[model samples]
Target: MSTALKSIRSIAPLLDRVLVQRIKAETKTAGGIFLPESAVKELNEAKVLAVGPGGFNKDGQRMEPSVKPGDKVLVPQYGGSPIKVGEEEYSLFRDHELLAKINE
Candidate 1:
């Protein structure tokens, strides 16, 4: 297995879900003033790191997740469960939580 697959396998996102790492908000302005956490808007942009096998549909068939690992996505402001992985914070949510895939 590739190193990327190994790292993703270690995580094993559950129930046809995925884990997303949120992009941290910029703290410094163009003027060089540092902004506090409270001053920053809640960020909905994230990068997909791990994904589960597709969820089962009503017919018991699997439906694949549209977003894949490494895809940048837009999530709802309050969706997903918050988790701390190593020293970084991330959110684990079902594929349904994703609002859109960001285009380059």
Candidate 2:
């Protein structure tokens, strides 16, 4: 984790909420050509930074989170509240808001 992320420890996620940072879009092409800012598309991929313990069920049982910190996950194109910390950008999403986890 980067230094900027270290500060995120102070902002803990409550219930099933999760903190994530979106993966940056590639600015270069396979042929080594550089793409302008407007040419790059924002990816819907993000890295899980922090996760809440679990949400309580109807019976009061804790429900485990489907994803954890350090996991790369797919997020929806819309939704999620944008958060800006220093020069980095982050988002808050419910555990169920995540689409899927990426392996490798």
Report the number of clashing residue pairs per model.
Answer: 0, 0
**How much is the lDDT of residue 96 in candidate 2?**
92
Question: How do all models score by TM-score?
Answer: 0.83, 0.87
Model 1: lowest-lDDT 10 consecutive positions: 1-10
Which candidate leads in lDDT?
A: 2
Error of 2 at 23 (Å): 0.4
What root-mean-square deviation over C-alphas does model 1 reach?
Answer: 5.0
Q: Which digits, one per residue and each the tens of the lDDT, describe model 1 over residues 1-104?
A: 11323233367777678888888778989898999889887688999998888899999998898889999999888868777644567778889879999998
**Candidate 1 wrongly placed segments (more than 4 Å):** 1-9
The CA lDDT at 101 in model 2 is 96
Cα lDDT for residue 93, model 1? 86
